[model samples]
Target: MVFTLEQHDSSKYRRKARMISIAMAGQLVIFGMLFSMLLTSTFGNSLWFYALGIVLGLLATSALFAVLRERPWMAEMRYVWQLRQHLSQISGFLPTLRGAVEEDNRAALDIVTFYHAGVAQLATLNGRTPPEDAAWLAEAKYLAEKREALGLPARVERFDSQDLQAFKRS
Candidate 1:
């Protein structure tokens, strides 16, 4: 699915994310205690049992986080999180994307446009603006022109997340 931009409260989102993270940490601690007791009762308090209980607690907490993260209250936080993840994923393969662009690969060009657009969207969402002459802005402009030269749109605001995988093949 393509992602669309929606304004959000950066401070509120950060606060909510921090609160959720703290809650998850508390869940882990409580589970750790409970698991430790249960395992001690069943396994005679061995040191290995304590370690295993912690591992189990971590798994449980992770599962709980996955479920909670899908709830409606997490919408803003989730969107920002997903955007951050998409940005991170592309960064790892950027050299590849740039390389493909050098070859005039249309798909690469589209992906790059999407990438820069995504960055700009995130920055705007976070209530910050880059200077006109910033390196990122200049680079984004250059890429947009390349896309425009090929009779394509200057920038893409919505694109499929799966398009990121194209870099892997590059």
Candidate 2:
């Protein structure tokens, strides 16, 4: 089966985020275990030692939770969802493109625009169009090029999906 560029890009990104999250979880567990052992090792020496361990553990756990919430990996996962939604929109619109309906043509352009916007957002997160994103990027480019060749005006822009939280957009 042939995969579209958008699917290729988004799936690679989702896979990368999944790998990182798994690695981070593993590291957290290892660190917690090691720190617990070190903290409890001096249990008989002083009560303050145990107290320090509690404080340190609490601080570490809190920090870990905060990181997991705000890290780029979390954002990447959210992007994966958005990308999938955009893909579905495109797929749904594709069948109508051959018809002589203005509305359908507009709908198709809108779907392509959303797909490109997703690409831009993913690019911002990665600081570059990721190599994995190349496929989708190429597809978007090819489609846009085709639209241009047909004398159609197409414009696309990217915005942070998280910003739409005001209307519960996420």
Choose the strongest candidate by lDDT. 1
Per-candidate TM equals 0.75, 0.34
Tell me the TM-score of model 1: 0.75
User: Which parts of model 2 have CA positions greater than 4 angstroms off?
Assistant: 1-73, 98-104, 116-153, 158-170
Candidate lDDT scores, in order, read: 0.79, 0.55
Q: lDDT tens string, model 2, 1-170? A: 11222323556665777687777666666666556668678565455665665566667866776677667646656555566665554444444532412343544454455556655655645557643567666767766776686676665443333322222321
lDDT by residue (1-170, candidate 1, tens digit) is 56665667877876787888899889999898889889999879799888888889999999988888889999988898888887787788788888888788887787778778777767766667743567777778778778878889776666566776767765
lDDT of 1: 0.79
Winning model by TM-score: 1
